[model samples]
Target: MKITTLIENLKNDSQDLINESGLSLYIELDNKRILFDTGKTGSFITNAQKLGIHLEHVDAVVLSHGHHDHGGGLLPFFKVNSKAKVYMKRKAAGDYYFHILGFNKNIGIDKKVFEEYSNRIAYIDRFTEIMNEIYIITDIEEQDLTPRGNKYLFAKEGNKRVQDKFEHELMMVIKQQDGICVFTGCSHKGTPNMIRAARTIFPSLDIKAVIGGFHLMTIPMLKSFSASQEEIQAIAQMIVDENIQKVYTGHCTGVKAYKNLKHILGSKIEYIRTGSQIYV
Candidate 1:
């Protein structure tokens, strides 16, 4: 499998690529070209062009959640890719918001995009194999060590707003002959829980690598970490316990948190940027 970082919060040493506080990965596996996320805008499309990635030929699109940073490029993508079906959690269209400092900001995907590409969007509510060896796992029940940064995120339920349970979050698992590679958008459901969920579903397959943001930033306004050093250590220890071969994370994972994790995980963890390319 080959994966390219289409857009991310950071960039490589090259000045040719653009970076944003979002996540998107172009994945090629089993003769399939899959777009993991759309970043926060059409900038990912621009980067793709620079990287010589043909978005028009993409086979599928997977929105990690309802967050705009993940699905905001749906409109631009639909304009170019006419055949790929976009897959997302069934409840991903819910009214999500980021409430901080007594203010509420709408952070969900654009409703107009949903109405425009209703037919091409696939709303998944359960475990589904979208294609051969490619599966989407939605039922993440083990919630230990969920991101403390998620405290500010909420979803509208009827007339009242409640903390987001993140049922709308999903993980993509690509089962290869040796093991399985996991793709997460922001890991709002918690990285450890997502890994456990994948392991539970595919008990026989080894977890080769986990890619995407861990949502470790607690205060976005000040760019502060929500997870304490001990918490980060625990999360890293969990990864060690699971015996994951590698972890590629960035975006909302926060620099401080990444460094803390790096101090523990060492070479087992690596940061991915806008122009990063990985083969597994």
Candidate 2:
């Protein structure tokens, strides 16, 4: 399997591609072309074209969560990949709000978009295989290492807003040659928790790699959403204990958090950026 980053927060040396606080990946595995999480805007489209990725031929598009940064490009993606089917958690359509300094901002995929693509989008409520060896995993019970500092996020239930339980969050597990590769969006449920869930489902396969956003990024200015140093350290240790061979994380995995992880995981942890490519 080969994967190429279509969009990310960093551009590395690719001056032509636009960068934003979003993520997108184009993956090719065994006669299947899959797109995992379209980024915030059309930038991913442009970047994909430049990277020689044909979005029009994508076999499937899997959304990891309901956040706009992860699913915002759905509109443009549909314009190109008419034959591709979209998959997401059944609860991903809930109204989501991101608490800012003093107010809450609705940061979810547009409802109108979902309505327009209702027939094309498949709402997943459980573990289901969309392709030969790729599965969409849902309802991850956070038995341990739950995500921290996410109290600010809220979801609308009835007429009231409550702390987001992240019921809409989902993950993808792909069967690789020697092991399994797990791809996540922001991991709002906690990276360790997600890993544990994947391990349970595929107990026989070694976790070759855990890739995508870790949600460990903390901007000093946005203190409410950032993970604590101790939490980051603990997450790193958990990954090591789990014996995950490679971790390609970036985007929401804050610079400091990633640096610390790199220190601990050494070459096992790699910073994924725009235009980056990986073969498994």
Candidate 3:
């Protein structure tokens, strides 16, 4: 199995949005081409073209969330690969809100944009095995994980917490001779919850490595967005608990937070910033 980042703040030899939140990753598995979330703008397309990716050949597409940064490129994608199958969580169609420091934002998307190919659309409310061993972990139950509603979280109708369910996120397990590799867009549903869910899905499978965005950009979420070094150290310990093999994170994961996580995860943390690639 091989995964190529088509869109990210990090570009290839081409010049594009270098600090953008949008990320498009091309994942190859089981002889099928799977397209992860389309980056915010058409940077995904430009990057792919510059890097020689044929968008028309993508077999399937997955959404990691309704955020503009993740969904903005889908419409344009349809204009090209109109026959590709699309998959995402059922709650993805629900109305979402985002309360910013100065304003309230409505970030909900229309179902038709993704559901037009009804015969090819598969909505997973919980979990679904897309192929023989590939699975899509839909929005996790908000029952136990931390509350998504926070000072930075936005909502609609008074801007309540939008339960993304990691709605657009999927946990891909690529079976290797000795272990499996798990890839995700962002663990908004919580990394611990994602790990546990993966364990339950394949009780005997061992996760070899982790790659993609981590969304550790906020202080409230990072434990040291703007605090002293002492607080950052505590945050590092929190990340070490996951025991994940290699952490190749980027996008919302800030430079400071990445450094802190690197200190804790040690050599296990394989950092991937803008324009970097991790081969597995």
TM-scores for every candidate against the unseen true structure: 0.97, 0.95, 0.80
Best-fitting candidate, scored by lDDT? 1
Model 2, range 1-280, lDDT digits (tens) per residue? 8988888888788457777889998999888999999988878999888877889999999999998888999998888888998999877888998774788788889886689989889999999998888998996888666656566678899999889999999999998779999999988899888998999899888999999988875432252245776777777877888899999998888677788788888999998889889887
Please give the CA lDDT of all the candidate structures: 0.90, 0.85, 0.62
What RMSD, rounded to one decimal, does every model reach? 1.1, 1.7, 4.1
Give the winner by lDDT: 1 or 2: 1
Model 2: worst 10 consecutive residues (lDDT sum): 217-226
Q: Which residue ranges in model 3 land beyond 4 Å of their true spot?
A: 12-19, 110-120, 139-151, 157-170, 219-243
Arrange candidates, best TM-score first: 1, 2, 3
Model 1: ten consecutive residues of lowest lDDT: 219-228
Clashes of each: 0, 1, 11
Q: How many residue pairs in model 1 have overlapping backbones? A: 0
Model 2, CA-based lDDT: 0.85
